[model samples]
Target: MISMFDSDVVSAELLADIVSVSKATLLKWEKSGRLIPSQNSITHRKEYKVSQLIQFEEVRNMINSNWDQELNVKPAKDFSSVELFAGAGGLALGLEKAGFNAVALNELDEDACKTLQGNHSQWNVIQGDVKNVDFAKFIDVDLVSGGFPCQAFSYAGEKLGFEDTRGTLFFEFSRAVKEIRPKVFLGENVRGLLNHDNGKTLSVIKSIISDLGYTLIEPKVLKALFYRVPQKRERLFFVGIRNDLVKFAKFQWPSPYYRILVLKDALKAGELYATDVPKSEGQSYPNRKREILSYIPQGGYWRDLPDDLQREYMQGSYFLSGGKTGMARRLSWDEPSLTLTCSPAQKQTERCHPEETRPLTIREYARIQTFPDEWHFSGSVSSQYKQIGNAVPVNLAYAVGRSIIALLNSIDAEVDLGSDSLAFNGSFHSRQLTLLNT
Candidate 1:
């Protein structure tokens, strides 16, 4: 047998660098059985076969060709949607651009509601907890969407169904879906939710979605970099079509853009934006932080710091085994920006500007999220950061939104042809016999 830890086994870091993706992307690949890893005897760290690296590189190149395909994304007819937890309108705005009309937007955050109202005075910005609202009044809606926060559920000897999640926000999202009975629904969350509670949580979510009479598509965590957004944020998106509409609609995910975008495309006048980022308020680094970060070269991290400074900055973490890649990290203009954090200057997640040593300004953060320069965030600076950081990148949402539109169009056309039709999700289409009954 070949040696498990031979030179052919490559650490994930080397493979990520070789393919120009993040370590997080590599982890996802490992879980999906794309890049199988074996333990290195000397380091006991994850390593992959050299052949795997070449395979991934070829796939990456093929994705670049997909950017040229024209998407027939126009809304087939006037479609309306209701959005829950509409923070600063990132997802809502993107869906609107993809041609869904926003009927009403509900958000508990006062600042977020104000931001929505400020941006669109005519919008019905409902400011209150989602639990108190009744969604049935919003009839004839084609879609219901929300980026619900992920919370671990308490499994106390009960079946994980719609009622089991009563205490959590997901229950509220499900309730809205049940009451409104939209043709389709969308739910977005952090990528970690996929493996949360050893994947039991996601399994339960799918069950509840089925219990509510919708066919939940196999969930996917989409990397923002694969879209037009110049950031590496990843979001887990679930698209569920009503059982009645599934046979008529075949959902296809939005294709990746022709090219990967970089931080320069976000900050400067480029294909993504018509003008350079505007000057805006931003957080400042303390004197001590400024001194430490000044030494970090663009795209470099704490390892670049002197030994003493690294010890002081990382505290006891310096002795830790894992690669603390984000510590004192400075972004490079040529690469996609790392995922934005709720705060730009946290010691562990310092996103220093490529040219400037300071943290990126608010405008830059918005730009990285593919938020238009003119979109104003209403709140304290920190709150503004939180809203943007928590949002789905506008361009990524737009791409997915277009895919949903296409599915809806197909469903509409099929309905016109035959009153009783069926649709399926991704490639996990249910058997024709069971699909009709469901």
Candidate 2:
């Protein structure tokens, strides 16, 4: 997954694979004069080198990244954290990899609790509603983190504050930070949070975070594709430092992996996994549906089918506006998977296999989410799907965790020296700017 390509010069097909686009799409780009490639001297076939492809952001990031260096980051001291809404330990496991010790994890779902406790018996798994659990007991924790469910706030007026957010799950997350009084807090949510309720929801959230005596860093949505997860999932992350320690916090978002990962990397015995995806049960389409989907090509959707089949399969959606691309969609092996939903065979968002006619198996879904093969899910099939779907991808979480570790390390340096002069150059400052701007 880290070393994305074997050769410096690659064919057009390989280039398409690297960028997670179809070769036909590349042809279209060339026709539109967006991208024009050189031909190899001997074969006279289209070829591109890393330097020549710098115009493409994906290729440029792959060339500029310091992913190997970032992986070497280590915690300066024993940092402890308390996690709320810890579903099946994806975030917890990733943070653990990044050197944070979980002091406690709160989850209301019994199956998710079992998954957490089953995987790590030593974790102080608090299996109950977060509203009932008191965070006051946790003292001197380095971080308090969670992906609280987003609920729109009731509009009382133009400005909304902490008390105004009382009934929402975001308030509970804010409450934990208030009680624990950690040096820093981390929150994550879907990208929709940015525009929720026409931005009022996020405005209230920003206000509440400030009301709790913390300095909220401008929130950013991190793409899983840039973090070595073989899926195009995006999550909005909120990081805040206690006002007293805000001066010490010099945080940079995690660097992109040198190369993006695709479905081939996930399911095959390659950089991402030790073996091909393990066999497991998965949802299946009915006979008629399967027969209809059999006609669909890789990376294609309902529109790829014959006219009669398209009308039969899409029903009234056949006449709908917008590109109903997810309907009857068959994933491409060369591209990262579409963002995974709770189920594989949903009518609105079908996730059919690249070559096979059936839906992806449970193991395939877990692999795409970057869950370790050994980690066991602890509930019925549907519950397992729900837990994994709700989780932040493990690799994405690990990337964010490393950035947090760097931030904490900087704080430590500041505390010891009593000045900003001891600032930790913990980020890929030069490289990050280049990739981000592009």
Candidate 3:
């Protein structure tokens, strides 16, 4: 049983047990000003008060809650979206901001589905494998969007079709688009997809979309930092229009925000928030690792450490050729953080705090990904971290959502104007020049 004491001072070990954190992390929090110790009225020794712990419920509850923040801004237009492979609710929330209602969302992870439902009970979340669900039942969606994993297709013939691309997640995603036949579709993936299988993978994807009677746009990679997310994330975007309507409308991607946001904007009450990041459950480094990282300066990496510590931290990889940028790295408050991974403390891609020697907490991870403060996550500490890291940054998804809305609006306008006015043939360039000159 836990004891509730009043005005009594407790040691770091006691605080660690109460908060379920390590002593090293509690010490680091003290140094970073996140958690300060109170002086005992009589003893004059540093100790944490029980009242202080109770005041941080926002952080404590985050261990098992999903975030749900209302959008403060107004929407430019109204549209509807059908999302596939929805993980956590980053993309869904973003699309909501662009004035689109999520008619349906499909996700395989049960916890992620719970997170989505916990926040937005009205959302139609299909919790199962995409292969088991039939997308044909969902009709009249203005747009179909997903961040499908990139997979290499077996090239048995010159062209890949829906039947030839079996046993791959991409096949399921494409089949949904073919069945629903929405006015427009959007697909996203890691930037490496551009060069996967020597570019054959992307080529096959384009061919499949074309065969489904859609006009594929030249895919481009969008940098998240440019779109108001405080992370240097890059994702490949592929947009397509139903071929019948392609000649009638043109689409443009969203423009970058005026300024790039940094870590300070994400975690604290500044440009991106109204208050400091709430305290929450977080992972901690071992004693030895914590002491070694203490010497690393903000915005510095392994090179900033002493000669011996550098080689020790890097191990045999120290002699390797690549930049090894993530090793022993500390983030800078003024710059976007590196792309987050499933595990915050992994040696290969450490996302240490800007001012502390520890990794970012669960709440900090959510904030950097643009999740609202109220959104709660369920599961163990490690599982929560994995869900947050795997999600798309909400702001980045909102930017893409705005572009989808614009395209849908154009399609609606074209349809209202009648087919004759929007018709385009081989003489499109000459006709456009004539209209401009006239």
Instruction: Please say which candidate is ahead in lDDT: 2 or 3.
Output: 2
**What would the per-residue lDDT of candidate 3 be over residues 1-438, giving only the tens digit for each residue?**
013232244545435533446667988988987777877666454588554555454223422222122122233356677999998888888888778888999999888998999999999999999999888888757788889987789774127477788788888988888788888898889999999999888878878887888888899988787677888788899999987677666677766554457789899898788999999999999988888889998777888999899888888988989778788888978567888989889888889999988999999999999999999987789989989998889999888877777677776676656534545554765565464222
Of candidates 3 and 1, the better by TM-score: 1
Flag the better candidate by lDDT, 1 or 3: 1
Candidate 3 lDDT = 0.79
Task: Write the residue-wise lDDT of candidate 1 on 243-339 in tens digits.
Answer: 8888799887777764567899999997888988999999999999899889988678999999999999999998999988888999987678999
Better of 1 and 2 by TM-score: 2
lDDT by residue for model 2 (1-438), tens: 224654566668556655668878988988987776789897666776665677777777777777888899899999999999999888999999999999999999999999999989999999998889889999669999999998988765226567777877888898899889998899999999999999988888887888888899999988888888998888999999988787767898898887668899999999999899999988899999999999998778999999999999999989989788889999988778988988889889899999999988888889999999998898888888888888999999999999999999998887666433324443545443353223
- Model 1 clash pairs? 67-258, 246-422, 246-423, 247-422, 247-423, 248-422, 248-423
| Candidate 3 least-lDDT 10 residues | 62-71
Error of 2 at 10 (Å): 8.7
The candidate maximizing lDDT is: 2
Where is model 3 more than 4 Å wrong at Cα? 1-78, 419-438
How does residue 217 of candidate 2 score in lDDT?
91
Angstrom error of the Cα, residue 164, model 1: value is: 1.6
Global lDDT scores for all candidate models: 0.83, 0.86, 0.79
